[model samples]
Target: MSKLDWHADRGTHPDLALLDLAPESVDIDLAAVRLYRLGRVRAEMNKRDIGAVILSDPINIRYATGTRNMQVFSMRNAPARYLLLTADKSILFEFTGCLHLAEGYETVDEVRPSSTASFVAAGADIEAREKAWAADIGNLIAALVGKGARVGLERLNAGSAIALKAEGFEIVDAQEPVEMARSIKSDEEIKCVIASLRATEAAVADMRAAIRPGITENELWSVLHQSVIARNGDYCETRLLNSGPRSNPWFQESSSHVIGENCLILLDTDVVGCHGYYSDFSRTFHSGPDKPTDDQRTLYKTALEQLHHNMDILKPGLTFREYSDKAWNIPEIYEPNRYYLSAHGCGMTGEYPYLYHHRDFADAGYDGVVEPGMTLCVESYIGATGGREGVKLEQQLLITETGTELLSLFPFEEDLM
Candidate 1:
């Protein structure tokens, strides 16, 4: 048989198995490219007199240094330092508590013996890890900085970056340039997010089809998870497969709730697709044989219709609130006594720049207009907060030239009841 040809009858392919895990090599070049771009940013900051820029933010650290340490991982503490535009170039530190952990490696090949995965079959080797940790970040930053440069602190944070900054380093914040660099999604980021949405959709669909009256919420999560794995996706984010009424919005899972009759299974499995990317969605499945009662039918159809309306209007230049409020026809919303808005953007952390006001964005500063790269989840739900029944139609979409393009499942049915 040809190397390219596979036995259709074979249960699984060896090559496919070998290619399983998502690329482990951190996107270091991506970080470096952003670093080079930071020089111009530093020039801009210099004009602003933001002296001794220090990057306390995790995103900023990753942006300046090609390694994956500090920042969010060490929320209470950041590892090393990266100083751009300083005559010293960049300076990384070996902090006190940071002695034990090895920041991610150069290649997966080196990752085997002491890596997160390998150490798991056996426990991680603290000694080897510390050595690697000490070696990698220092060398990498030195290379980026080009040795013996008069580097000063470029930034610092109150919580994590504090410990590192105390070590005889100057401190500053490149907040503007670093954030500007991180703000826009690159072509590659968009593709990964797009694949993410697809994986999420598949998982949800699988769970929907497999959802049964006797199955617990957790069981449903397992079924969907299996499907995601089959597609080379993962359900690592959000405590998935765990759901209950008292639970927060993003929690979706199974329980002993005994999918009995008359109960509408409310689900907010917002992050059930990929470890790298996530898509937020909600669906209230009718566990038992459900008849579309008059009220249920009206609300479901209205919610679905409202989602479509906003989807039609979701292109560039439309303010965030505009897309949100338009989803619920004000006149109709008032008529039905519905209070919730339609939906918002779905990406990292399940929902960043949360759409539809829910206390925090009361002023809705997210007047940030839709751009082509933005991926939004259009979901409108009402009826659960003491009102009768509820409806939430969720579909992931991206803004496009002519109109918005739907990346999520289509032909959105009104009654998943």
Candidate 2:
């Protein structure tokens, strides 16, 4: 397989010496890209008749405002940050200590300090503090949205929802609008994703080189983590680094379990790389000094086949339902632990257009058309019913006018194949 050519000479940064030239001389302007994203979101909102949207999800906030501060903390604690987007204004409700960070960002129309009371503070009435927080948010909503006016809300806490309802505002699910807007990426967004994939693939190379017998799973996992951070990337979203027996059933996080000789090592890099774009892909490796057993080889071959089969069928204008109907049928032996979908859309993180298998579509999938400019991660996990281990493989791709373009370039283990 041909690898992706990363153009290091055409860097993301503009040449400083060309500052005297006209603004149009710059090839790419990230600030303009962010504005384009915000505009797309607003257009989606307008199409849905959503007068305003309250965003608490960090990714959503970043998409709307292009500000990254305390993202990890904000994900766990809802009160840490939020963004309120109205037709006429955009406001950021920031945590007490982080308000200063929001300043000078062009996307933010206003930055207001969020509530200070901790949700789990000792000796404090948690319920009362929650009510107070809700009241504050309600007041803000009341000011923007008239009484009984409909507003969009994305992942609001129960307390806040109740408060908004009591304040006479109609709440609507706003996540779909944002998700739709994010489903198809812009050129700049694709650039960021490519940058992230480059860093992640490099890290995976480091991990492959460092893998050896007797190394604990946690130690091996840290190799990828360290490589990513050392290159200015962000954190890995999940701890899906496992080996040996843990690789059979899948979904196992890294642990202290030592990798024995000739064990199967399964790894998924869910790293949020440069500029917070996510690079998600999985690979299976064989621990050295012995070759993979026949069973292991069979599992690996089957998984790789499934991954490629799914990838080969992807094309522009293919609907989710159509793709599901035509997707590769899993053999009976490997059906027990089959993943929910053959592929999922990826940008900042796994987002929309989740392409499910035929059997699972009715229960968990939605219908949508695959269009140009969308990125998807094809996935596969193959292990027999009574097998000792499984193989997990994934690839990231970009949908084009004619077919698909591979974004991930990590090679499969040729020995196992």
lDDT of 1 by residue, 148-226 (tens): 3222333332322342233323334555555444443445555656666667677778877876667776677677667
Q: Quick one: best lDDT, which candidate?
A: 2
List TM-scores for all candidates, in order.
Answer: 0.60, 0.90
Rate residue 258 of model 2 by lDDT: 96
Q: For candidate 2, list the clashing residue pairs, or say none.
A: none
**Cα lDDT over the full model 2:** 0.82
Residue lDDT tens for model 2, 1-417: 111122123331132223212232234455666777789889999998887888888888988877777788888877578888887789998987777766545688888987633445513576576677767776776687655767788766676677667767788998889988888888877777887788889999999999999999999999999999876677899999888788878898999999999999999999988667889999999997978888889889999889888899999999999999988899998898897678999988899878899999999988989999899999999877777788999999999889999999999999899
User: How high a TM-score does candidate 1 get?
Assistant: 0.60
